[model samples]
Target: MSNAPITEIDIAAFTADPYPDLARMRAAAPITYVPQLGATLLTRRDDIHVQEKRTDVFSSEQPDGLMTLLMGENMMRKDGVAHLAERRILFPAVSPRTVQEHWKPVFETAANRVLDRLAPRGGCDLVTDYAMPVSAEALKAITGLVRMTPAEMDGASQAMIDGCANYAGNADVTRRCHAATALIDHHIDLMLSDPPPRSALAVQMQGGLAMTSIRANIKLVISGGQNEPRDAIAGTIWALLSHPEQLELIRQGMASYADAFAEYARWVSPIGMSPRRVARRDTVGGVTFEPGDRVFLMFGSAGRDEAHFQAADRFDIRRDTQAAISFGAGPHFCAGAAASRCLIAEIALPLAFRRLKNLRLAGDAPFSGWAFRGPTSVPVAWSL
Candidate 1:
């Protein structure tokens, strides 16, 4: 281990709002090991952008890692050939063309259906009432688990996410995670028995991937797929409503919903930190890391890196966020990116704004979580 200074963080405070702490860390060092997280954090945009691609040294394949242990060894945890092979197989399901041709209509219907139900309410918690169901319905159709209700889909996804990030080894989290995976397995079994024509599960099944791999990958998709889009949908709406000036840019056609979505993701990354395992003795940013060291590529921090972004903390939809690593910079970049873009930018945001007239915050929208961050509840009102 290199002689890098060890950093201590208040776990609770960090979870509540990590930007302040992360800003301090970036200013202090290039790499700092945090005892609470049990991982060395790479908070700088430049370092993460460069080091993330160097998979030879910082590997994703961690057999004993929390993700592998809790959610099964999915492609996100693999490196080089293994990772690429799975990604290739999974590509057809989430490719840009596929997302446009197939999932776009599905997402559109889901968004409209959810909005149809909520539009009459005049006000509702956008998180549970709107974003959650829209995301879950779309994910259910895409994953070929249509048998699952929106609530079930959201619950399972949240449970698995909690389990994967259960760094504290909470028994309840692990139990819930296992229970959720078991439920997903049942759904997979049903789907495989009578596989849907073009769902992700059906596509992967046709690709001749193993049963275990297919199940793990499906669970992986649900874990990130449902929550990320859900978070982004609600979070982006909250951001826009909070920043009327930015929203005016969209209304005036100065900025598109896509621009708002990208900026919000950079401003409050839904998927914050990606964990990696040191594959061997390697030096990054003048700090040496030994084999088996856990590293957290802080996408949240990198997005707001002062060196890369001017007035980084402020949410500016007009700002170009090309340097943001919110979806990651390496080979393990999110496979669901196209789907997310279509869902949030194309369908969800545009539809929500159009359907919900005079949409504005009903109450304080509180956000939490550092690893996977978003508004827990976005209370909003709209003219019926």
Candidate 2:
């Protein structure tokens, strides 16, 4: 007997409100391919985790040559020995210790700088004005890129991210992505000519890392370091604002703000899905897959999987969120997860809430993007 024909779901609707359909898929066909995307969508936490751990079967280093086009030759596109070598070179700068000792102060300083401007307005677009600037400046400090400002980095980062979101072959997205890549490459070139006094790139050079590897990995960090924290900070604030009871818990000292950030990572999960490839024929979740298949580890759906989380749809700051896949798992776990957390939990969120006292949502703001989902513009108002 042949496998059932692949099903098709509305891509636009899925991007807008994925929860309803994701819920259906999670309940029924948690591991089946959709003809439209030509990939198996794994929505359940267990299935996603299973695929993520077995880099042997579901390789990041796919023979199909798709990621190479999108992400270039970075650590995300490597596997096994090659992946490890790249990780080792990049790890020193983003390690948990480094985040605590070096980047935390940078994050706090950047957060305060953005807050200084935002606090005076008494109202601002949290995503653009506050979160994006804070993330951009923090990344600037971390990467030590001398030529570009946070605004430039933010635009480039958004384009790269938007390209991934529109990976299904949109002409405008592809054009924007290529243009952003060229701009960032130029910035990288400028940085090389006039190296920063002390940055991660300099450390990589001093450590004898290859120039090509340095460029690719630096771009990866630039993409991630700017994007993830911006979304995380915005999502965390939105979650708190939407659930005032939970917000009250923090104000009343009943719950820690750090736990709220952790909960946001689980509940909303700034970046939803990470893609992997079927390196060799493998069977998972009662389905057999041939080589060269695309499997998307749906972290957004998994974060809300009923089996894994109690009242999964509800946003609760007190929920046990240590198991969330916001930063992913296995060999591909986010290298900058520590810094992202430090920036949100310790620096950005705390300062924003304190400075924007009695901050309330101006109105309902809708978040977009299936690949990376968070508030596009968090219209927030508060007393000066």
Each candidate structure's count of clashing pairs: 0, 0
Off by over 4 Å in 1: none
Task: Please write out the lDDT profile of model 2 over residues 67-151, one tens digit for every residue.
Answer: 4675578888899898888788777777898889988887888788788877878788888888898998888877877567878
Q: lDDT per model, in order?
A: 0.91, 0.80
The C-alpha local distance difference test score for the whole of candidate 2 amounts to 0.80
Lowest summed lDDT across 10 adjacent residues in model 2 is found at 1-10
* TM-score list, all predictions: 0.98, 0.95
On lDDT, the candidate that comes out on top is 1
Model 1: how large is the Cα RMSD against the reference? 0.9
The collision pairs in model 1 are: none
lDDT for each residue of candidate 1 in 1-384, tens digit (9 for 90 to 100): 544578999999999999999999999975999999989999999999999999988889999988798778899989989889989998988999999999899899878888888888899998999899999998998899999999999999999989988999999999999999999999988888877767889888988989889999999999999988999999999999999998999999999999999999999999999988888898777788998898999999999999989999999998989999889888988998999999999999999999899999989989999999999999999786
Q: Pick the TM-score winner.
A: 1
